[model samples]
Target chain A: MSDALPPGATLGILGGGQLGRMLAMAAARLGLKTCVFEPAGDCPASHVANHHFRAAFDDAEALTRFADACDVVTFEFENIPTAALDAIERRVPIRPGREALRISQDRLTEKNWLRDLGLAVAPFAPVDDAESLRAALDRIGAPAILKTRRFGYDGKGQARIATPDDAGAALAAMAGAPAILEGHVSFAREISVIGARGLDGAVACFDPGENLHEGGILRTTTLPAALPHARATDAVLIAGRILTALDYVGVLGVELFVTDTGLVVNEIAPRVHNSGHWTQDGATIDQFEQHVRAVAGWPLGDGRRHSDMVMENLIGDDIARLPEIARDPAAAIHLYGKAEARPGRKMGHVNRRTGPAA
Target chain B: MSDALPPGATLGILGGGQLGRMLAMAAARLGLKTCVFEPAGDCPASHVANHHFRAAFDDAEALTRFADACDVVTFEFENIPTAALDAIERRVPIRPGREALRISQDRLTEKNWLRDLGLAVAPFAPVDDAESLRAALDRIGAPAILKTRRFGYDGKGQARIATPDDAGAALAAMAGAPAILEGHVSFAREISVIGARGLDGAVACFDPGENLHEGGILRTTTLPAALPHARATDAVLIAGRILTALDYVGVLGVELFVTDTGLVVNEIAPRVHNSGHWTQDGATIDQFEQHVRAVAGWPLGDGRRHSDMVMENLIGDDIARLPEIARDPAAAIHLYGKAEARPGRKMGHVNRRTGPAA
Candidate 1:
C-alpha cells in the first residue's frame, strides 16, 4: 500500500499498438496519465496518451525522459528491448518484472520454464541450427511447428513441418535464428484464463474463454467456455499457480489446451491477452484496468463475469462491416484509431453480450 | 449515413472537463480522433484527446485551427460562448445544433419552449430587474427560486426566495444578469432521462434513473427508478418529443419531477448529464459513446440498461474514500484527473451494480 502510485501519477507504456491504446484508455478511466514510448509516428496509443516519446527503443535520452516522467512502468508487448527496460528500471519500477519478460520472450525458454514448473506443456525440443533441428525432429516427430525462439508474433517467424521430408524447408524458414520444435497436442478446444496478482499477493482470475483462431490470429473468444465445472476450476487454478510462481504484479493471460485427460499449457503472455477482450464487456473489471491496478499497486478489482459474451475481431477489410455491426443492440464495439486498414491488421473488435452470465 | 464521418475523422470537442474526457475516450474507442478546444491548460480531456488547442474562446486563429482539423464538432457543456460557436460553425457542423443551445442556455427560454411544446414545467416568469422580480413574484407566488438565465450550474447563480420579503435580496443577488423566477413543484423524487437523436432521425433513450442532490449538486443516480411502467414510458415519451421538436442531434439529459399526478419537466441539458454517468458501467453503450455516435452522423447505439446500477459522485473531499471504494468488488470507479478537489467540485464517481436489470 505504501508503494501504491496515486491517481495523478503517470504510467509509462512500452508499446504503441492497439493493446497500448486500450491500456492507456483504461489508465485514463482511473485518473491516471499515460506516456507512450514507441518508435512509430502517429501510432494508436499516441492518440489517447498524454505524452508520446517517439524514439527507437535504444534511444537512451528519450527513454530516460519517458522514465523520469512516469511513476511506474508497464508494457503492452513482451518483445521490448532489454536495454530499454534497463534504462526505465533505473528510474521507475516495471511491473511483472524482467523475469516474466526473459522467460516469455523466447518460445523455447517459455516452454522449458513451464515444464520445469511442473506444468503440462506440449512436448518440445530446442533447435539451434540444421543439425539440432534434424535431431529434434527425430525425437518430436513430424507434423510439428518450427517457431523462432524469439521475436515471433501473430504467426510470424515460423514454419510448419508437415512431414520428415519438409524439415529442410522448415529449417530454411528459421533463417539461422534459434528455434523450437513443438509436437502438436490434440485438444477438444482452446481456452485462456486472464489472471492478475496484486502487489499485496492477492490473485483474481476471469472466467476462462473458449477461443477460435483463423490464420494463426485470434478470431473470436466466447466466454463461459464449454468445459465441465471441474475442468474450468482446474484452468483457473493453473493460471493462479503461474501468477503466484512468477511473483507477477499485473494481469497475465494463460492459453491452455483442454484435452480429454487434462489441461495442457499452450503459452503465457506477460501482458493483457487478446482472448481476454471479452472481459471488457462481460466482467466487472476488464483486463486492461486490472493490469493497470496491479502495476500501480492498487487492489485488484473483481474480475467476475456478469454477462455472457462473444468477442469477434475485425481484421483489415473487416472494418467495412462496422456500419452493420453498429446496428446490433447487444454489440459493444472498440476500434483502434489506426490510419490504414492493412491486410491481417486488427482494426477493431465487437463484444456481443448474449445474456446474463450463468 | 452518407454524411457520416469516417472512423479516422476528427471530432472536435469544446470544454475539457470530465464529460469531455469521457466523450473523448468513447470517440477513441470508436476509432475516431478528438481535438479538445479548452481554455484551461492540462485539462481533463487533454489527457485522452488526440490534440489540445489551449486558447481562449475568443482566439479566432486558434478556433480556426481547431475547427479546420475536425470533420465534425460537438461540445460537452451547453454554455459555450456564442461567438466561439459562430466561428467554428462556419467551418464544421456542431451537433445538437444552435437551436438546442439557444433554448437550454437560458432557463427562461428552456422552460418556455418546453411549455410551448404542450409539456408540463414549473411555473416560471422572466425577471429582468427589481420591478420585474416583484411582478413575477406577485404572479408566481412566494417560496420560489430566482436563477440566472445563463451559465448556472451545480446550484450556483441561484437564490431562493422563501417569501416576498426575500425578493429584494434575491433580485440583488442576480447582479443585473437576466433571471427567471420559478415556483417550486412538490415532487416525490427527481429522475432524469438520458436520450439521443441520431442523424437519421432515430430516437433512443436509456431507462430513467432516480437522482439525489445535496447542496444543489447531484450526489447519486439509481437505475430502475421507483416509477410505474406507465410513468416511465411517459417520461421517455416526453424526452422523445423534445428531441424531435428541436430536431436535436446527439445525447440530451432531460430532468423530470415525478409528481403524484404526472411527470413535470425540471430542465434539459443539451449535453451528457451527471445523472447519466451510470450508463458507463450498466449499459451496453454509454451516453458518451451514444453522443459521439449521433454527432458523427452514425446511427444511435442501443441505450438499453443491462444492469441495475447506483452511481455515487465523489465530490471534493469525498475522494479521500477512494482507497476504501476501490476495494468494493461491485464498484466501477471513474475518476476525473483533477489536480485539486476544490469544495463542491466533482472529483469522480463510482457505479455500483446491485444485480441484472429487470
Candidate 2:
C-alpha cells in the first residue's frame, strides 16, 4: 500500500558479497524478499536470503530464471558484465540501469562522464598498447597509474609507473588490455560522499569521511571529515550531478581527492562503498537502508549524522582481534561471516561513535 | 580459527519470529550457517534462512535433525516447550539455555526468580483456582491484574480486575489456566534493559529505553530513558543478575516498572525483546550482533548508545505507511518480510536517531 514498491515484491541483487548481504538484510526489514544471483557458493548474501541462484553471471538460463523471479534488480558491485545486465533488463527493472553500469564499468568512460558533467578529474588518456602507454606517459607525465578499463577492484588491475621504462611492463602486467593512464593528484586527503538518488531525482548525502588505506585495502573512514563545509557541500553536489546525469536510482559513492583548490572527483562506485560503513552505527539511516529504499521505489531517508564516527576495516588477520575489539565500550563491530582470513581479505569492520572533541 | 565458533559452523536458532530472522542475517555475516526450527510454515525467520524445519517444537525427529545441523542453538522466543529444549540439547548448545526459558515462560517463576535475586517486584501471588484468586484479590485489593502463569505475551492471556465483581470474569476469561495475581504499582513510567551475556560471563547492556503501549501492543521505545543515573544502573544490574543466575548466554531483556520509590522488575524475555530495537540504530553494537557473538562463542560487544533514540512499531495496517515513513528525514524504517499483514501483528519498526530534547 506504500507509494513505493508494494510489499511482497522481490528485490533482485547481483554479486553476493558483504555489501549485498547487508542490503538484502535492510530490504527484508521493509517487507521485501530478495533473490541473490552469484557464481560463488555459500555467498554471504545467499545465506540469509529468500533464495539464491548459484550460477555464473553469463549463464543465460540462470539469468532468465533470476530475472523472471524478481520485480527489481540492483547490484552490490559495479563490475557486472553488460551482457548480464541487458538480459536481466528484459525481464525486470534494473535501477541505476545499464547505462550507469556501462559508464562506470570502464575507467575511461567514468572520467569522461565526470568531465562532461563539468566536474574536475585528473588528466587522463586511454592506453590500448605499449605505443599508447608511452605517448600517454609523455603527455600525462611519469608517476601516474595505469588501470585496466574493466573488472578491477581494490588495487588490482592497476600499477604505478614511476619511470618511462615501467610503462611496457605495467601494460604487460595488465595483459595488454584496454587501460587508462591517469596523472596523480597530490591531494591533502582522501574522502568520499556517500549518498542515494531516487528515480524521482531526490538526493540525500551523508557528511563526507576522511579515508585511509593500507596496502590498497580501506583501513578506516573517520567523519566530521577534515574538510571545510563548503568543500563537503561541493562534494555532495558532485555526487548528485553524477546520479542525475546517469538517472541513477540507488546509493552511489563518489571518491574524491581533496585538493587545495577544491574536491576533485577520483572515481565512482555505482554501489555502496566501504567508507560508508560508519553510517551503520553513526547516522539516522545507514547507506545500506538508503540503497534498499531507493531500489524499492521508496522515498529516500535522511543521511544526517548525530555524532563523530569512525569505521575501521578488520582486514586479513585483524579479524582475530574481534574479541578484544568487542570489549571497547565505544566500538560497534560487524563481521561479514566470511570463512577465510587470507591476506588482504575484508572479514569485518568496527564503528566507534564519539562526541565532538572539546 | 576463533575462540568463538568459526565460519562454516552451524548455528541452531529456536523460534521463527522477526527477531530470529534478523539474528540469522547477523550470523550469516560471520560466515555462519543457520537452521531455523519453528512451528509455522511461513515464519519470518524461515524466509531468508539456510533451511527451515516446520514442525511442532516437541517433534523429536525434527528436533534431532535441528540439533544435528546446528553446533549451537539459540532461540527467538522464550516460550519454547522444555521438552523440545531437552531434545535439542542432546546434540547442540542452546544459549540462554533451558533454565532461563523455564523461568521466563511462567510469570510466577519469573517473579520468584527476581525476588530471589533481591530485585524489587510487584507484590504477586499464585492464583491456580478461584478460591486462591479470591484470596489474592482480598489481599491485594482492587485495580489489579490476573495474568496466566504461562504462555502470556504482549498483554495477552491476562485481564484487569478493576473491582471485586470483575475478578470472576477475569478468572473465567483465563480459561481455568494457572495464573498470577499482581497488585498494580503506581509507577511513574516503564522501561527496559537489553543486555548480552557471553559464555565467558562478560555482560554488556544498552541504555534503558522508556516504553509506550497502545491497544495492548508495544507502540514505541524512546532512549535516554527518563531515569536518573543510579536508576539506570539498578535496571542494568537487575538484568545482569537474571542472566548470571540463569547462566544465560546471548541477549536478554528485562522490562522494568519505575515507581517513585524505585525500579521494580516486571518480566524477562530470554530472547531479544522489541524494546531493544533502538540498539539497531542507536548503539555501536546492536542486540542482534551481540546475540550472534554470544552463541558463536565470541566476545560480547560494547552496548553503548551513540545517539538519542526512538523506535516505533509498524503494526498490521500501519505498515502500509512505510513510503511516508521512509520519507522522514529522521526515521530508519524496517519492515519484516511477512507475506501478510494480519491484525495486531508486528509488521516492522522504525528507529530514529535524534538529539536529546532541551
Which one wins on DockQ?
1
Choose the strongest candidate by lDDT: 1
Write down the lDDT that model 2 would get.
0.85
lDDT (10s digit) by residue, model 2, range A1-358 = 1446776788999988989888887788777888999999877788778899999989999999999999899999988877898899988889877888889889999899889889999999999987888889989998999999999888889898988878778988889689999998889999999988876778889889999988777899998888778888999888888888888889999999999988889999989889999887777678987898888778887687777878999988998786577667677667777888898888888888766321
Worst 10 residues of 2 chain B by lDDT: B349-358
TM-score of each: 0.99, 0.95
Interface RMSD values, listed in order for every candidate: 1.0, 2.7
User: What C-alpha lDDT, on a 0 to 100 scale, does residue B340 get in candidate 1?
Assistant: 97
Per-residue lDDT over B161-232 for candidate 1, one digit per residue giving the tens place of the 0 to 100 score: 999999999989999999999999999999999999999999999999999999999999999899999999
- lDDT for each candidate structure: 0.93, 0.85
Off by over 4 Å in 1: none
Best by TM-score: 1
